[model samples]
Target: MVKNVGAVGDFDSAHETALLTATGRNQLLDAMHWIAEGRRLNGEVDGPTLLGALVAAADAGVAGAEPALRTAVRAALRSTLDTSADLVMTDGIVPPSRYEAALANVARRTASGTLVDITGSVVMAAQADDPLVIEALGLVAGLSWRDLQARAYARGTSLPGEADGSWSPSQVFAAFSVVDDVVCGRVEPQVPGAVAARPIELLLGGTASGWAAAEAMREGGVSYGTLLAQRDVGSAWSAHRNRSNNEISRLMVRRVLNALDEAGVGYWSTEGDAAVAKAVLGQRAGASGKPPGQLSIVTRAATGGPGYAVLIAIARDGGTARKTAATLLQLPKRFNVPSVLVLFGTGWADRGESDDLVRAFGGRLYTEHTLEQLAEAASTVGTS
Candidate 1:
């Protein structure tokens, strides 16, 4: 204690000579005093030795700061901690200790392995859920952490302050969210669709319910066709019913318009596709026809994912039209557009062209792991 060591002297002794009360807390105070006092030249007794002691205390997840520990931490992290940039750690590389671990912590994402690498551009994550992180990881982490995500930086871009790369509570949660956007045909593999997982969230009424609806379709047994037959696609947007592209997101442009016309949601004089049609639905059904029960509405769900088998896409007479649709699907997904909405109203296409859309993606759906297993696929994608 300071008093025991005579730092506070006998001032308290005069009041109570027998006092030995302040030992423990006062000793801690002494450590703090020496730490703040700096080197011996600052009108204090201790030098770097005292300061080092204090930092050691704190570095142990303890109570004070010590110069030795501070220097070691800085030594290890000086390259990564600048305020101007992110010391991004990817591919499950754990961050190095101390100064390197600035701000918050991160966990490996469920969709992490699903990522792809593009050539260029730089973007900072605005928040943990911010889409920018997805853009960065999906495009940037080509080789190593030191590789600079520089490819992300080349085309005149910089990381933003809000980018926070965090994940859901469990594998099930993470898988479920991506599934709704991916498998249940809600979100597809467009440049924009792949940019962030939240576009599907924006559609389907932005309700947790609609999101759950999307998830239900992927859990392996539920059939979206059957559900559509039993229920209805609400005013809220719906997914592709199977995968990202049916060449259908754009086609939905017309179908949605027809629905609007029938509902008397009011009519517009303009003869062109409305602005709302410009957006894509997060989901898609590789097949264009109605499910067994639902007549007019298109169905996108999980079973269609496993129903995927390699089949020949017999080309149709509407070759150019199908080609245009495929090209159209490429755009929004490439740019990370939310809905792509490619195949929205494309029912009149030559039957052979429809088969191509189904074949290409269906072959991919298996590798995509859209459904867990055939037995569970129907129940998960089939039931309510």
Candidate 2:
């Protein structure tokens, strides 16, 4: 089933009154913000609407109508909110000073109410934590989830001289890198069990249809796969590989393909940032087992062949870099595949950007001097 990330239309259909009624003014407005920014509010699974429904149900006097919804609410709280303990809340307006207490109270209420007695496999409440609670508050309070991740990195940003001292360049890059991974997650569209490509997905863009690009990264990004074909073109330049092909983009893709073939990794190339975004994000997903975390490649250009490629991540999660740039040598841990090195190069047939492609993507004149080095760099760019 295709899933939509927003609930504006659903909210309108669910609530029906076009004017954004009094009782739901805050709720509707909050819901609208989420819908406008592209997040979901459905009453099913771990969605924002589940919380709204819980409050609504409680307001409506339904005692157990919240079991399924409650479980889902708790699950999201733990995963997205950053709480490590079972979630809890108090009925009244939560005071800033008593936020922790409010959570504990909610936990107590839950433990005494349905949490302690849940027997179905619908939710693993025991493993549920407080981070989940905060996320619920984030959605209800109208806070941006993206800001939450930014705040996490921001913490590391303010620590005395050691802040800049410890953060350095790569550390800072790594923190935001983490934020990049989290903020844009589930944002890119998907194509049947795989994420689809997107033109302006979050901060980075990619080629391949959002869904097609994501699905293209099978094997958890072990190979260059489709994830790197077209990502927000960080660099670009056109080349006339064959006068017959003519356009800079075609030359870029053909060159990239040739490089991948030389490295023995397969790929799914595309023309736009959407398709590339689909591929880049897909490489980090496993869909089964562990979300794919290594051997990455990200190539996205502004429409010129021989586009720019950035060494986003490398040699991570016991994997090899089938294709990716070299400067992404920012992350600490990397899993290198000497024989299965991941390589990346982007550009269109219309313009010439081979210089940027080489510099950012890494190879020849870029960062990698050997297959071993390149393999390691590309492998971890996505996961780290």
Candidate 3:
């Protein structure tokens, strides 16, 4: 009962149902054949190519291509199912029932034509079922689609159709390939805690799920050094370290704000705006040299008590820590308000560098790694 949409070599009147031009028809047939052969060889489907071809055919009003498209979809789904089965058997991380549910979700989404990137969809489904699947997948896959889009934009590569809220299958698959490579141990993260911090960076842009993921990682004793011995964290962070720093900075700000809120402290904050820093601290530029360049957080007690200005910095080692501390020391003199330094991350080069920061901040230094201590410290200034 199925019509062979590719059997006719040319566009002829006899094939009235085939509305595509001869070239278009040929390309569709070729892509379908390639995907079938690929699946046969290694259970891999060239989903982007096949999906692109199908989309092109539909755009060209080729109604006859539907049958071939359906067949290709079936093949792709089967390939993913097979791979999931193997993962369940080998890693035992994904349960069979969970895989089945994920497959069913993919099937429905694909049926509606909203899920062109089959592999990414599968990984996303697994992520929804268990966020830890991201770690299990070597921390390369399972990023939310929005995070993936942001990362792509940061890399100066805009995924096709991203503006319309539809993901291009090719771009999604290409990103997923990095995950596959990491899963296979073909790539590794350059930084020790980059794996744990990546999701935090990507999801820090106002998503509660991202904050939950960070909290979960912290409670589970997962840190940047937690997976230092694992050889499969992927190099996404190193490849985009500059962007990662900005993201981590944002994450740190959010963490501090959240901690402050939990401690019932009333305060206002800003991100690197010198004017706001001057206004909140009520400091004039005439006598003081200038507002600090990286004035991250400025807050006062709701009852009009003494305010606190916080400078957040990230230091990977003792040298950077010392340099950051020295820089931080210069800013407090410009402001009459009390100043605090909130340092994030692990791996201080030496205890002395931390001591210098504490002494510089007048014993008001806080580390984000300790949330409870951070909250307790933050509560000191504004809750009087």
How many times do residue backbones clash in model 2? 88
Better of 2 and 3 by lDDT: 3
**Weakest 10 consecutive residues of candidate 2 by summed lDDT:** 234-243
lDDT of 3 by residue, 261-358 (tens): 78776565654563565465444221165556556665555555555676677665556657766777676666667666666644342434443343
| Model 2: per-residue Cα lDDT at residue 111 | 31
Candidate 2 stretches greater than 4 Å from native = 1-131, 141-146, 152-351, 355-384
Off by more than 4 A, model 1: 1-319, 328-353, 360-384
Per-residue lDDT for 5-60 in model 1, tens only? Answer: 11111223221211112111234544343334432223221111222232334434
Cα RMSD (angstroms) for every candidate in the order listed: 33.9, 31.2, 33.0
The candidate maximizing TM-score is 3
* Ranking of predictions according to lDDT: 3, 2, 1
Please provide, for model 2 over 14-53, each residue's C-alpha lDDT reduced to its tens digit, 9 standing for 90 to 100: 3322212212335544433443343433433222233333
Please give the RMSD of candidate 2 to the true structure. Answer: 31.2
The estimated TM-scores of all candidates read: 0.15, 0.17, 0.36
| Error at 232, model 1, angstroms | 46
Q: List the residue pairs that clash in candidate 3.
A: 193-224, 318-349
Worst 10 residues of 1 by lDDT: 363-372
